[model samples]
Target: MSKVSNRTKIAAALVGVLALAGSNLVAADPLADVQKADGQIHADAAASQKKVDKFFDQAQDMLFEYGTVADERESLKAYNDYVATLVADQEASMKAIQDDINGVDKLRQGVVPLMFKMVEALEQFVALDLPFNTQVRKERVENLKNLLSTAEVTLAEKYRLILDAYSIEREYGNFVAVTTGQLNLDGKDVLVDFFNLGRVALYAQSLDQKTGWMYNPETKGWDTMDESHLRELTKGIRIARKQGALDLFALPIPAAETAK
Candidate 1:
């Protein structure tokens, strides 16, 4: 073989080796691609961490605002409860007042007639009684009757007057009274000493102790009393007036209900 041909073959072999090495360098690497993908994932994680930090700060501010509102909410709720209680009490009180007002109208109707009946009963009692202090008692009854008819008098006032009259009649039954007054006997007026004995009996005597009479309820008049009755009746009047010593004396007694 010629030296030139041999040199050409060696050169060709060296060129082929260089070309294979160049192709190997230009080929794709799997490890390098994996590294590039991991770097991209790390960048995404950094951005997400920044967003979480900002959200945590906002959450802390929201919690602080809620705490501040919690204390105010309790105070406002307590004040509202107090107001509700007051409103309930006011409604109940108003209802009670309305009920009282309604009852007053009914009471006035019943009490007014009752007061009139009481006054009439008092006048009848004065007429039936033993005719002592007649003018004063009759005047009281007349005053009560006039008050009942008057528009200026209230029912409560009329009722009080009736009760007072009844009390006076009741007191008259418990004791004796001796009075010097004008006595009408047989259509003639005479000054006499009157003996009132506990709503049971009434005896009248002249100043000289010579003339006397007993009251008769059925006939509504005065009748002449016996001589024996005069001694006991005169002594009773003197004793009642504190002009004589106290002593038990024989006297006629009758049960008469003055208050009734």
Candidate 2:
């Protein structure tokens, strides 16, 4: 072959070799690139996790501070918004870190709203003070005592009949209805009214557990229920207040019945 042709052929072969080497070099470090990308994703995911944690912590602190109306309302709104924003932002983040976590975003959704409601209830309770020695408080307590007595007598009699009439499943429902119904048979809103009245009495004693406020039949005077009984009784009162069941402070108290 001619030297020029030979040189051209050698040049063409070198070009082919260079192109093949370049292709292999490009293919060599795919795993390294993947690892670098993974590391970056992990770092970003960690940053997002920090943001999520911050939001939750802020929410928790606000919930604990939810005593006053203004403070609670403002803090609650901010906390709720932060949680909601986190949830909204989570969808986009989930795709990025699906392999790293399982249902982390969804877990907050159920918990956050419930916490929000609980704080809201506590806010209402603190804002609405109970009436203790006032006529409304005194009259309501007497009315509840009367209603409880009447209901206890009536249900004690009818409970047997109810048990005879209903199946086991139906009887359970009947029992609850009979118990609560007897409590409500009299025109008095006994449970909630009594709870509020009792709460006021307890509050007046300055959170003292030793003070008893139940009616003392022998002394004919109200005696402290003591700390243990007070704790039990106050739990119901707090629950009623927190659940907004005791929001009828403006309602007129039922007239107390004369003893038979």
Candidate 3:
């Protein structure tokens, strides 16, 4: 009919070009891509949040079941099954996190501070309680600090190491050991048998079994115990080291000084 307007011709040409290049400009599966990305973000958030939720769930369950117990076997069974399911779900959620962008860095920012605090607390405990294997303990704390600073070590491994340290420290409270090391006795480095009696006492025995000293935390010095107590100290060490039978014996137990 009538001649088409120039504007209409230009519009038609533009539409043709867009159609030819549309595949390159626009994503073919935009919704699919969005769904995948959103799922990943959600999964990552869920992964971390689920652990907290599970903890609270256990707490609440305990609170609910504390005073109410209609059927012992049924309740116990149900509770155990629920806990198992929660654990499985938590594992699945963690696995579902996106490989490229799982918010682990953000988690480490919060966790690194906690790890530092734990280490500091550990250091203080070692300082106040008893200075046994001190250099070794210091090295362990230093290693943990260095590991935390590195990018290669994962957060989980760091946390596990801290827990292991704590466990070792706790286990120390239950056991005694006889280790020989250098001790500064009266301004002299003496090679002595350190008798660690489960944080209850710390004693140093001379090579000739002639002298014994108890650790004094106040001045960080060693006070020589009475030679009359030598038999008791020897028996105690023998029992602790499993070299002899255990029997009741009176040995020096260092009293922790009250802070002024």
Q: Where's the lowest-lDDT run of ten residues in candidate 1?
A: 251-260
Off by over 4 Å in 3: 1-106, 256-260
Candidate 1 lDDT by residue in tens digits, 66-104: 998997899899999999999999999999999999999
Clashing pairs in 3: none
Give each prediction's root-mean-square deviation over alpha carbons: 8.0, 35.2, 35.2
On residues 56-130, what C-alpha lDDT tens digit does candidate 3 reach at each position? 999999977965665776789999999999999998877777642467778778888999899889877877766
Best by the TM-score measure: 1
Clashing pairs in 1: none
Write down the TM-score of every candidate: 0.64, 0.23, 0.57
Error of 2 at 99 (Å): 83
Report model 1's TM-score to 2 decimal places: 0.64
What is each predicted model's overall lDDT from 0 to 1?
0.83, 0.47, 0.83
Report the lDDT of model 3 for residue 206.
86
Model 2 TM-score is 0.23
Q: If ranked by TM-score, best first, what sequence of candidates would result?
A: 1, 3, 2
